[model samples]
Target: MCRWLAYSGTPILLEELLYKPEHSLIDQSMHARLGVGTTNGDGFGVGWYTPDGPAEPTLFRGTGPAWGDDNLRELAHSVRSGLFLAHIRASTGTPVQQTNCHPFRHGRWLWLHNGRIRGFPTLKRTLMLAVDPELFPEIGGSTDSELMFYLALTFGLERDPVGAVERMVGWVEEVGHRYGIDHAMQMTVATSDGQRLWSFRYSSERNSRSLYCSTAVETLRTMYPENPVLQRVTEGTRIVVSEPLGGLVGAWQPIAESSYELVTPGMDVVGRFNPQSAQAGLPVPATVGANGG
Candidate 1:
């Protein structure tokens, strides 16, 4: 499992989202309130885009706990961006290596996942065989989460993100079921093209890992009138996270299961996900049985 956050809108220092909150992602790295584990210290990563740079994002990832990393604190304070994705990892079985860290990058895209493939060793070979060869060499990690990212890319995630992701999940579940592993895929993924952000929350089982998004800045300002930080953000800013970074009640909303949310230049759009099946070529079933049984 892992903890992550994605931000889109007005440019702000990374610290504002990764450290300033009372229970920020760094805090969750040591004391998560809702994650299966209390700590997500296996490794961490952050990706951001700048105005003058190429469309590709700048990324920093390390195989160390976010809570104890001095470099992380220093970098968080100095970097600022209008869009970014940060992740704190809790390795399920993968080794704690830089290549295995989250916020995996491709050409102009960055991706991170918060869940796992229930039986990765048994399914990895098959899944790896399915990725497009041109995109295959770019994969730098052994994590199933990273594999899923490339699979979606191979399936055309950059062009039709929601469709591509749904297809990737469908393939995951299909392979899991083939191996007699029910509900083998669990995920809350955030992906960006240095412009728009797309996030998905779903598992073969109906009970997916927790994922949330912040309320509109204007709404939060009205709800917590006395909070000065809320006042600083513009009306269009939005944040999506694996958990609420702070204890600000009403500041976050759970994303619906079997759906995806899109964050563009000025607005956020959410809709149900329906991936066309690779086999039947029709909408695939996104539901899973209890406990993946």
Candidate 2:
């Protein structure tokens, strides 16, 4: 169990989302209303694309609660980015270390997750052996979240992100079933390649972790014209978080179960996510519901 936020849009200081909101990510670290745990204090990490850096993002991570990290506070106040991701971890039986912190990076891509691969310790070796050998050496942590990233990479993330992630989940579920586990996964994952932001919500049992995307900026502006914050960004700006950053009423929309939201430079897209399970011999579209919007 963990909490994370992904941002894409107008370049602004990191604090605009990380700290300034009423129930910001910092607040979630201590009072997460949706996460399984009230406090996600094992570790935290932030990744962002600088306007003038290499295609890769700059990452600052620590093995401490995001709420108490002084360096995170200073960095959040100082850095500005058009796209970024931040995460606070509540370990699902993993060691607490900086490397295990989220917003994990590989080249220009960054990934983070908020749910565990149920019984990861039992399935770890089987799943790990399936990772692409060339990509295997890049593995740096013992967390299922990081391994999930590599699994997606092994399945082709850079070219087709959605497909890669779908395959990754399918594979995990395939292995879990081999061990007699009924429900193998629960995930609300967000990833970015310094351009578009992609997020997904799915679980084998049809009940996944919580995830929400901001309502379209134009609509929010129409709803709250008096809000100064809404006036600063273009319509392309959007945020995907494990939970709402603030109680803005209409500011957040829950991502449908077994589906994904993609925020690009052009139009944003939401679509059904059917995992291409090897066990099923094809991609299977699990049942999806409104989630009581």
Candidate 3:
């Protein structure tokens, strides 16, 4: 129900990915081809790391369509970073308030999600109770996506990101089954701790949301031998997004279902997801219609 992009590598002007591409994130906010909806106008947010600040990221978010936000346009043109996360929201049932927008932050970590819990309200209480009390106060929104972040943090996300997120998804599915809801979770999440970037694509039913990663810098260099921009980036640069930003067909590859990917300073690693045993014990929340109203 949303679109997002995570980038890591040589620092480049934000507009190169957010606005310059043919199918840029801004363009997707108005014409998303792969999202559940065609438009994700509810809100938008961006989180990026800079050399001058605390290792923690700086965030800019708004409760309006990204395409109409002049501030976002200006900032995207001027700011640059080696790592960044950007999201355009299509609220499932939450209010379109600024706090509810994504690229949510807590200390040095930043997170964003592109899917919803099938039955959030019914599960909210139980899920909220499960978050580590210390991290609970850092949650600033009512979206199930944001709640999911805190749950991962509760399970030690800061130390073992892949494991914690898998645990969170496992708990969500377990709760769904307890309520007789067949498929209660769908998500493609991206998180960064100002260094490595972690991303996942999963759903209980096996047909997860769309997630893609850019070609390896070496591969891109070989494919576009004459493109200077392609050559300017370092071999370690990588990008993960809900959809490809440009028409460079060979530049993106879809992430497999039920898998997680890790982008570090030197390499990109991908692996299968395994749920935690404890997660299977949580109760599923009751279901409700799509009246997100």
On TM-score, the candidate that comes out on top is 2
Q: List ranges where model 3 is wrong by over 4 Å.
A: 279-293
Residue 161 miss distance in model 2 (angstroms) = 0.7
Badly placed stretches (over 4 Å) of model 2 are 278-293
Candidate numbers, best TM-score first, in rank order:
2, 3, 1
Model 2 clash number? 0
| lDDT score at residue 71, model 2, on the 0-100 scale | 89
What digit string (tens of lDDT, one per residue) describes model 2 on residues 37-112? 8999999999999879877899999998999989899999999999999999999899999889998999999999
TM match of model 2 to true structure:
0.94
lDDT of 1 by residue, 1-293 (tens): 89999999889999998998888999999999889999999999999998987778999999889999999999999988999999999999999999999899998899999999999998887778777777889888799989999888877788888888888888888778778899877889999998899999988877888999999888888888998877777888899999888777888999999789999977889999764554433222233222232
Predicted model with the maximum lDDT? 2
Q: Give the TM-score of candidate 1.
A: 0.93
Candidate lDDT values, in order: 0.87, 0.89, 0.87
Q: Candidate 1: which stretches are off by over 4 Å? A: 279-293
RMSD list, candidates in order: 4.5, 6.2, 4.1
TM-score of each: 0.93, 0.94, 0.93
